[model samples]
Target: MPPSVRRSVEQRADSVGFIAVKRAANAIAEAARDSNSVRLSGAEHTAAYLLTRMPATYAASCKVLDELRGVPVASVLDIGAGGGSAALAAHEKFPLAREITLVERDPLLAEAAREWLPAAHILAGDLRRMTTFPPHDLVIAAWSLGDLPAATVARLWEAARVALVVIEPGTLRGAAFVRKVREELLAAGAHMAAPCPAAMPCPMVEPDWCYFAARVELSSMQRRIQGGDLSYQDERFSYVALVRDPVGLPRARILRRPRHHPGLIELDVCTAQGRRSERATKRRDRDAFRAARHAEWGGAV
Candidate 1:
């Protein structure tokens, strides 16, 4: 996250009282655990979703959008835009986008989105029932594909004229869904645009899933709601970006934080060849070592 945005989030967090926020956070967490639990409705649930989940979702969406930076985007379609986080992130990243559409099932959530994202064309309906989607320059499904079927997801990719980005929670289940979608899209001839070095099969095996984290400053409301005293929170997520046209292939993706030893920098990376550990020594490889020192997890090296 940028310092300016961090400061803005912090200021917003400072404005809300802690106790009420904590209660709302607890309720939201409980509700999220069970799919059969009460539906997200009413003002309190909407407020809870916004205060707790929106920032993390927005931060995750920002990371996904970063992969497509500099691409021409005149139109965007945001699927399952809970409180409009993805739409807001898209607008911030592609300010020139003239047509923005948001598809959300919940009327209350869709209504909330209108207030936050007035410029977007909000479509209130279940995505599963929709047979066709409007083609757009960019299509994003952020933390919204876990429950969707593979056919529906494929339709989403087919509707994208330029790119398709999917973001999911950083969990075992989320990784499984992302991997499944990645394989499906790859088979359909889409090119991997981010988080992967090449279009070859994923090298990571069972019990190990690919995921990344984005640091987001928690609003006072978010901090209090989550029962955390920290100024910022790390939102972990798993994502895949597929493009209609191939972009320059990245060499490899740093899988984790680089470890520095006496005069060596060790990196865990995923390449077309497979997952491997590479070492750069300051004495022998000064430039590579320097680049490794600055490399971040999930970034291409």
Candidate 2:
């Protein structure tokens, strides 16, 4: 990530959601301790999905905030504020906010965050156990909700006043997380933030159906790590997010011949959050990125 992006991410690490990112990153790092394979693969996989959906995700989050009657987010809370990038975006977008509290669990990472992040109020503790909670009008959890025990998320949302945003991976696991939160939030009476995955026979039809993207500007470090030399347009990957209401249903703009890939859904960027349609990919190009890495040497991802 660039200094600007890194700076942006670090600036907003005060929220619990953003804090949890370090813990999750630690987990992934641990899982891939042998090599950078796990981290690299995971990052690439996730970026792919988030890049394309950035517009939608960004729009949805803002929409959710709006539905909350435009609450003045004086104090904000980011759970799983990994690297505080998302928090930074929020900070950039909402600067007048008084305080941004990031709650991260990993003490090592939290300490690192202190050195790396000088702007936000970074705190360390298991968010699930938090009591006597501080006042925070906004709460965000992107790609972190799935790692947390389901009950923990329910407990935290009870404190959220203005809005609660949960970004999950665009996979079965991600899909499940999205559903779980949507159900839990509705049960808790939280309002809907984003539209449910509309349409059926999801594009992730067969071999090539599992991917998502986020629009992001990459940093030289990220570019180097990813073995790239240019600015990333749409970071692509496979992702799935759970929302508050109407459960996410797949929405297809133009139906193409569905492909089958065992457990994948064949789909594309059709009606991007109701904006535009996209072309579905052919089977050969589905998992093309998989051959780029190796477990011994980055898993040829």
Candidate 3:
């Protein structure tokens, strides 16, 4: 095989691979929106999410690894793989990588991904409820870490081989969780690359959400899951925060952009002059907090 022909063959293969991944993402997005697979959220404090929520979640996941890190790892473990969007993206970009594992908690999502992404395998397991997980060169947790109990977060951090990147929805709690994780990792002597490159301190504050995107390919099972269509695009920009607090974390910055998704949020936690107070039960409960803070710190300053 001549070098030019070999290169052409490899390029052709890459194009085919790209198409297959895109097909899978489209199916997952469509299936999630499917009424038959309708997953009602039953009013869980936040809006009804998943299945049909943010479609572009695929690109965001790829960004977490490729451009953001600008470095490659031999292995990747995507915990709570969701619809397998990120896993497929990683496989597409790192064609020669050693291994890529997609860990999903929901059986249906795993099943859908199995057919959607033959190149990338799927595992049905819960990060919060798991006893043990195999170590990998890199770990990516997208929008699933905050839902996990605090104790599990600590345990998972300890188990990471190189770096653990945790992404949560762009919310106050999500941004705050990044700080908490950083503190935990730093206390353990893990490196802190960019504490919050997406924002100065943290972008997960009130009403100031930042965004980014990446190109994600589809899986075979995903196409079967959604009836083999490609008109729709599978994109997402949920709140993303990258933390490389592991042994050899790299330097990066918080990314900012505009998109269909809502930005950062502002909540009325209602504190008393930078002092902790009893938890408030009702909206009015914050009034007392405001008064307390104003009395001590001169008007919520």
How many clashes show up per model? 2, 82, 33
What's the TM-score of each model vs. the native?
Answer: 0.91, 0.54, 0.53
Worst 10 residues of 3 by lDDT: 41-50
- Please write out the lDDT profile of model 2 over residues 114-225, one tens digit for every residue: 5544667987776667763454666776545566677777656765666566655555556555666666666666654333334222333333333344455553433443
Q: Which candidate, 1 or 2, has the higher lDDT?
A: 1
Q: Whole-model lDDT for model 1 versus the true structure? A: 0.81
* lDDT: worst 10-residue window of model 2: 292-301
Model 1 stretches with alpha carbons more than 4 Å out? 1-21, 31-38
- Badly placed stretches (over 4 Å) of model 2 are 1-71, 115-119, 131-133, 197-212, 228-230, 236-301
Candidate 1 accuracy as TM-score = 0.91
Best first by lDDT, ranked: 1, 3, 2
Q: Against the correct fold, how does model 3 do in TM-score? A: 0.53
> Model-by-model lDDT, in order?
0.81, 0.46, 0.47
lDDT of 3 by residue, 160-192 (tens): 666666655444455566667666765665554
